[model samples]
Target: MATRDDGAGAWYHRGQVCCTNRKLDEALACYDKALELSPDNPLLWRRKGFALIKAGRYAEATVCFDRALAIDPDDATAWQRRGYALACMGRKEGAVACFDQALARDPEHILAWQSRGWLLGTLCRYDEAAACYETVLRIDPDRGSAAWHRERMRERRDLAALASEVREAERFMEVPACIREVVRERDYGNAELARAVLREMVGQAERPAVQHR
Candidate 1:
């Protein structure tokens, strides 16, 4: 047992080092070795899940995260990682539920909050997404990326509103007589000359209609 534990520790350390170096395959190999020695270590399982996620093996990563969560139900990191893997698998609803679980375990988990916000954005829940980002900003005022994301969400909402307003205004907009003429003459004359004529027509159109007293 002692020898097996030592091997597990060594493999875990090697896996962590490889993960830090972004060598996902090597990290996975070490994690596999560690799991062989200590199959019940939740931490090792979580590490393997993260490495699989980095390697773009999201389905396998989800299983690993689920295994870790089964071993340690209160593991907020595992929940958050599972949420990410679910999101990558296009299971948005499942991802959101996992994120909620992570937040329930640790409300101050910034990554969980961020992931929830991103999922909300994907679902087109801009208001909720903005609120989530605002919460993140409140928790970490130095989070420049969160601030930027909040601003972008606001911009998207505002642009959508502006577009609706433009559509409504278009119902009242009338093509000016000169613009109509320019369009009619465009094919028969130089485009520049047509534009010049259109500009003069606009000037005349803007002038109040002359009325003899």
Candidate 2:
């Protein structure tokens, strides 16, 4: 129902009202009309991108975000939304990079931090992911989801460390045949040298024993 007399801003406002009412298709039409009138407007591109996201057209949404960013490279929200669209497409590393761009522009961007942490967590980079959650909690202490994620990452990190320690302990517990040779030397009367080698093997001569109370 928009006429040639309607200005681009008028069409943009109509799109906003349509979006508020959940009429995504109508919103997209209005936005398209607005874009035709003012294709260089970064806000119109970003708004269309958000509407595309709500319509579950993530791939198209990314294109819209790309256009917005091309027009205004410093748009932190556009970068964040591009990352979110990439995430929905299962392109995690790409999504992380976009989120990183957003955070670079606006360090206190909570959504970027949360999304980056989520992607890192899925990648099993628990320590880095935990650090992201810790940053979020520092920025907003009452964020329960970030707190919960931080605890989970901490647990996973501890479990990874414990697993590594267990592997190391298992390796040390494997008795080498060199010990048997040392025992044989002791039996052959080179007892002092054998004891010295045995002490070296156990690291007892170089390391002090723990004092018991």
Please tell me which predicted candidate would have the highest TM-score against the true structure: 1
Which segments of candidate 1 are over 4 A away from where they belong? 165-213
- In candidate 1, which residue pairs get closer than 3 Å at backbone N, Cα or C atoms, i.e. clash? none
> Model 2, 11: alpha-carbon shift in Å?
2.6
lDDT of 2 by residue, 60-155 (tens): 999999999999999999999999899889998999999999999999999889888988988879989999999999999999999999878766
Clashing pairs in 2: none
Query: Which lDDT value does model 2 have at 96?
Result: 92
lDDT digits (tens) for residues 1-213 of candidate 1: 569989999999999999999999999999999999999999999999999999999999999998998899999999999999999999999999999999999998999999999898888777778888999998999999998888766655544443443344335454445444434443323334434544465456546545322
**What C-alpha lDDT do the candidate models reach, one value each?**
0.82, 0.82
RMSD for each model, in Å, please? 9.6, 12.6
Quote the positional error of residue 44 for candidate 1 in Å.
0.8
Candidate 1 to truth, TM = 0.77
